[model samples]
Target chain A: MKRVKFGTSAAVLAFLAASPALAASDVCKGSDINILMETVPDTDALQAVKGDFEKEYGAKVNIEAVNYSLMHEKLVPSLTASTSSYDVLIVDSYWVGEFKTAGWIKDLDALIARDKVDTSLYFPALMALNGTVQGKTYMLPFWQYAMGILYRKDIVDDPAFQAAYKEQFKRDWRMPATLEEFAEVVKWAGKYKDMYGIAMAAQRADPVVMEATNYLFAEGGDFYDRTTWKPTMDTPEAAKAVTVYADLINSAAQPGALGANFDDVANTLKQGKAIFAISYLFLFPTLEDPKDSTVVGKMGFAPVPGKDSFLGAWGWAVPSNAKNPDCSWEFLKWVESKDVAYKRALAGGQPTQMWIYNDPEFIKKWPAMSQVGTALEHSKGLPIMSRSTQLVETFAEVMGSVLANNVPPATALADSQDKFGRLVKGDPLLK
Target chain B: MTTATIRAGSPGRRRNLAQYVFVAPAVIVLALVVAAPLLYSIYLSFQEYIITYGMGDFAGFANYLAVLSDDFAHVSWVTLKLTLLCVVFEFVIAFGLALLLNQPHLPGRSFYLIVLMIPVLMTPVAVALMFRLMFNPSLGIVNWVIGLLGIPPQGWFGDPSLALGTVVFVDVWHETSLMLLMLYAGLKAMPGEPVEAARIDGASRLQILRYVTWPLMKPVIMVTLMIRMIAALKSYDLIYMLTQGGPGKATETISFYAYRLGFRFLDIGQAAAVSFILLIVVTLLTLVLLRTMREN
Candidate 1:
């Protein structure tokens, strides 16, 4: 099968390259397809290999990439239309439930069964959170952004600081294994002049909520009780998480932390001004790039304290009214194939396939791949519901108030609980 | 009244009908592009149209009430504050510069005009992004520049207390140039006779400005203020780029609130209602401004 796929692809490529007029006996020959994707490293990797697909399928490919924040608003109008301009969409994990419920995306269960696609190859978190809604698969996992701590190894591993940390905390200085240890490290590292302990993306609305999720997960608190559909934010665990998260931002994080987003946080670490950053594994490539990062080769990755972090991911799905559904699925299958997934990972994408993390070549190149594999295994995603976006907004608002207004964590959590309770009161997915 | 006279009247009526035919496309296009979406939004405002779940039941005034009781009050206040601050500051500064630039013998007058209008030429998002970088508390040039003056670095947009003012400052920077252009044009268009007459009558510059120039510029001022106010009220790109209505909603405005509702929360009905409310507010304000203009 592999030989046939490669043989066919190579012949098609040669035919197209040799003569533009020569047409292949492929359904996609001369066909045009457009894809809407978020502007991430994975998207860039996919775009880099777009010519391969175009050549192999003898089709014209158009990719429109927008920032993750703008992707939803941009996709909604196209998706909700009677016909979509895009054949495929890179659906964010948070958007899966909404898109599925609205029937904006096609269910891929029958397609998967027909093709005998091994869905187990994808990270379980990605499959559960982004690829499927309930028992129905709506998308093929494209990329995963398992959240973790990307820290400056040189700074954290400094003998002087380590000794000082050991003396101060009565423990050997190492990667934090718990939330309390993380706080201790942050505070200790923050005391140095000209260097912030952590680069936090605590900007209101989305950034703060995304950053706060690590704390929430560490404390074993979620936005709500998933099983019972009740807000768990008012619990003591949630209050502690919120308090710790806020303290980290207000006390130990870089200047303007309240206004920082993922870009700012990454830049902070790249500039060598921060000792640590709570970031996604996907960002490791950019950090490792010598041209973009001043601290290249000096960074290390780890799962966030308590072994739980927010899992960010996106999957590729054909729109329900796609002009070329078959072509879109073919593109997905080709991209998710082991070789292509490996190529993408090598091209700085965070591939969704778990096996790629275990690849010797990938592990050698990205020393943190093993850690990333572990992080993905333990990560949690935002609750999937049609109304999860609203829940996030409410969470962002509460977290924003707490960070910016100095609202007490308990009060903020209580307020969020009420809001979440109201939001999820009739949400059918919870049951 | 003979047949010829009747025929002439018939031709005149036909000419009028022909004029309507000529304008029909534009009217239809406008109805489709502008009026259609607006009317649909108004309709959506009356329905429980969550974007995710698709259109729901007839919601009547529920969306409006929900918005009004929720973030509407805060965002409206924010919007009003932002509009007033931006328009007032922009007008004052722009008028001041306009008066200066209107001078017949001002040095580098053309250079100043070109440089002043640069902000207007730049996109609002670009301006916001530029200002956001400049205002970065740690790495930005603004903090460094201020530190040279023996001042400590300050969180400009990151601080809730400073975010709104920071946004207003950026808005003024971006919007003042247009105001300056308008007022300057109005100043140049003014007949110099009144000011000369006031001067010959031994009136001071301030006195002449207060009496003659002020009265003559009133209509232009009113029109400029109305336009700027409307634009300021509808401002979203700047707020979105700079703050995302952040630092705990300090910079959140009506338009941003509407966007958050519709796009972020998928509450299209409430968003539409909020938009209608903004439209109403703008309409009423425009009416008041027009009345004031007419009174002048």
Candidate 2:
């Protein structure tokens, strides 16, 4: 084993030495530009774009594919070192404030203006998510997803279940209209012997934060008051919202839901163990694909039932220290363009362009894409804040505590409020 | 006559120089790798360092103050409790196993030693993950087996009250093997003269174990306890995989807390501060243990 490891290391060194010379002569001009991208499931679609990008620009794009969690860790150290290891980065939407406030991302508003890029083609909600403090675009949408309810059509379509759902909610049983109605349906569906009524991404980290925030926002609770910079999540409505969610999970969600994340929830739905699930539009193609799912044609999508507001889509952004800002901006525009974006949608990549939802080819490829469009139409981005990361983290802890029944919702939110206030006042940059 | 005396000393000096040359590489490697990083971390512990993707800042002593005042005090207390509990449990179990294995004419002693060492040899992450699956409330083998015994399924890691204990159980499973191995070796090497003397003196089996065997094994036990305590205090991977310090921070340890502060929150300054504090506590405990061992 040691001998093999040594031989492999030597081979790698040799390859590394030879590749630079070969790359300089063939694909790139001047210096090789490294693009650090968050790993997405659709690698094939990205490779196609990479081929075209290299051919058009005469610049080599070194794609450093990293897991989302590690990407964040790597970003911080690289940024601190001021090492141009990554010319472009795909960051989470919530990270925009941290990156922008730190001046770690390049302002792309001027670049967008220079390119005469048409913003009308892009989803407005997705576009809004990329804007920084001064309404400057730091990133553009590469792919877009909105939170929606995924349900088993076979169960929801059953004659008796449909009649009961419609009678209870005063609707066609197609989609839930309010948070209360959603909880009722979940409880109603959970009574079945073979399936869980609902499954959510409750696993620790960002997934839990995302789901928890959706409910918090839906209940008209803000992480912090915009004017006073005080957290308002400890309100009665917020507690009510949290309790509603907790009750649903406690009574209707699958057992062992505490450790389940996006992948686990998706698997549960795909395996037909879950009657319904809350997830992003990205799950649509996979869940609808006959090859990948047992319930391919049996799954359906709906907008997340909202009490007062809906959550928006997640998009992409570029860092401020990009070496090849021009090329990266061009790539962003091309990717978000109607034609290219629609092509990507057809190939099972979610499109951030508004026109793709209307495109016949895209709709035919995956019918559930329309539900994403509907969700996006009504969605609202998270309340903008300088201390968004702290808010999200504290909120997750609060919500998780409530769900675990370790603390009442009101107390959890109160603790979060105190912590958020401390963080804001403590950090001079944020203030 | 003086020149001949100088020539006679030259070979001895050359031999000393050869010894230094042979040891130089190892010293150089240690300085370059271990010592450098340790010193760098100490330096960073004093600064409020932010490693943003493109920019960073340093604030002196702020990181330390934050960690000292942060919510991590509770987490630190919890970690200390967990470390003590796990270590105590491991020692008792391992020492008992060692005593049993030390008996003459014990059946398949070698086979038992191999079987017992397997848990210690397994990777902590793999073991944690396996236990996680086994403890799954819905489909886990543990729950299934319990059902057969007419017992209700318990939320092992899911329940906030049980999460820490569950992780502790997993840690005990993985770590007892190390203690067993160490104690076994210690037991095997124990002098038999003390036992023979105790027997001649008409000491009961328990009395001999307590008065003679234990007294002689004191140094070994102390050293093993110190080593195991240090290892337990630094426990991160197993807990991380098992609960991720979740169910409302019920299972959050100091090391996991530091990681969350550093990586998850991107509050490197606070993380550095917590780590330094942890270092101070560990160092003090280690010194006390060492002094006790010396006295023994």
Candidate 3:
């Protein structure tokens, strides 16, 4: 079998060497398929799916799971060459517009229609975010995520703290209702020497961008005007949002909060040093795990406190150039199935499907599951645009500058707006 | 007559031809490995390239323009200042250490040499990470130590004001050994006659060092400075592992900015453009150093 497989791969390489532009349809048969994917937290579940896939299709699936950070660096050159380095790709939902605009991904509408794929099984919010590009479904949401405030239940439930908190805030102490109240809570929590008011991932990448968007959404700032293709984050509301975020990180959060990314925040929460953390719903199960978490039962989940509303969520989509589009769609549909999603939930994968959220048994296994599901219902997705990546990066920089006290919020926001506006205006697609 | 002439052909020609053929393989490999990628990068710099997970584009000269006008200009200036500061400081400290080590009667010189070499020999990433942990504002050793002395805890890498200086200190600790070893070798190789002649002329030890020793060590010092400057300019690992050009781009050097553009932003064209600019600047500096060496 090894000899046969080696011989077959050699043949495929020779064929590829001869014809660089060979289509997937020409070479995707007889046990030689390559799939590229970014490594996620659910590697074990994905491996199980891969095992099932190989058995059913009689094709070898080569999964090139990369650190999410390095995945794009590898993918860009391949896309430029139009080479079939990967037949299937798992991409972040934010990248959909950019990939589609660049003509790197294939449209899967025909394939989905041909397969009679049902979009109903997936979470309505996730599906809407993933597939819709000017009213067209381009990709599928495989898994969904939303940002929420994870807190220590023990700290919040303390009777003395509750009485003091109620007196200070002049309301029944629950999860914060507004950014001002949240700030006050953080300050109050920080007064205790042992406890950090909040832990945040402020490192200069996706974490900063994600957290910035939460603030942006709360303050009612949008990334683009949609019609004019002009960046809109330079408004007063946006400036206020940036100022608030900067203050939160510099004053109210943990000492080393600037260097902390998502994993660091999770570890900080799990270690019980932080009283509160604004993080994705996906981290709840892991944070609650008795084997990993020191504060397993102490962790509590709440919707992200907003000046207005929630901002970010994750979605899964199949790329257009997938070799096994049929199988990929089937897997996606199956994963989104109510029964399968519920099973996954029981197995500790956060459910993105609406029905699984309604499952009493799944919620019983993980107490925070219901809270995550409820948070998802009201979650807001990132504003879609051709230059969304640039916009996000600029926003992060502007927010960082404001937080570091290098630039005033108004000036930073205005600078970001001008920079992003130029990018959008320069790009024909954005126009 | 032709056969007789052929039999007398010179061995030098044959030997030289053989030498050329032997070196040909190395030259070809070098071209493939280094020259080819360099040329490709140059080509890419001229084109606008956006690299997503599996997608990107080509817009000529746009990337270069963008990088030149972008926030990276300030970052490049910061890097320039850091490189200059670090190279100068490392040279002075290293030269002083070398002078001390050169003393014939110095105690435990070998032990001191080995101890000094340890920092340079250590893995750069590990060293940077260790410093990062030690410099943490809240729970780090630096703060703990300071607190004992009744000094308030300093925000070592966390404060934008202190981050670059902290990084420079770490760089100096990790790299001064190279300078020390180079200068020491130069000092050891120095002719004893020059120092004796200076002593006979009633020169003080400091006078001898400034006039005779330093002048004689000029070539070695120049080479060390050039090498250290290049290394400092390209300093990425320590800075990357330490601050990642953060606390609001206070510590961002050219290399870090280029990396962020290429890898993080997936803007390969912009990264390539920045790299080409860096290459040009370094090459010009190198040429200037070589010219000065030739003139001297």
Clashes of 3: 5
- Sort by TM-score, top down from the best: 1, 2, 3
Off by over 4 Å in 1: A1-25, A192-194, B1-9, B150-152
Model 2 agreement with the true structure over A255-370: per-residue lDDT tens digits = 66676667667776887878987777777767776786788889888877774344544444555544544445556665666666666667778777777778787788788877
Local accuracy of candidate 2 as per-residue lDDT tens digits, B243-292 = 77777677888898888888777766677778777888888879978897
TM-score for candidate 1 (chain B): 0.94
TM-score of each model, in listed order: 0.93, 0.83, 0.83
lDDT of 3 by residue, B98-126 (tens): 99999889999999999999999999988
State the fraction of real interface contacts model 2 keeps: 0.36
Deviation from native of the Cα of residue A285 in model 2, angstroms:
3.3
Name the weakest run of 10 consecutive residues (lDDT summed) in model 1 chain B.
B4-13
Among these predicted structures, which one has the highest TM-score? 1
* lDDT by residue for model 1 (B1-296), tens: 69877876797877988999999999999999999999999999999988777789999899988998887888889999999999999999999999999987888999999999999999998898799889987779999999999997777888888899999999999999999999999999999999999999999989999999999999999999999999999989999889989988889999999999988888899999999999998999899888887887
- For model 3, the superposed segments whose C-alpha errors exceed 4 Å read A1-40, A44-68, A81-88, A114-117, A132-138, A192-194, A307-344, A426-431, B1-66, B99-123, B136-155, B192-208, B264-269
The lDDT of model 2 is 0.73
Better of 1 and 2 by TM-score: 1
Q: Residue B143 of candidate 1: its Cα lDDT?
A: 90
The residue-by-residue lDDT of candidate 1 on A258-299, one tens digit each, is: 888788888888888888887877778778889978988899
Candidate 3 residue pairs that clash: A106-A320, A140-A316, A141-A316, A142-A316, B48-B59
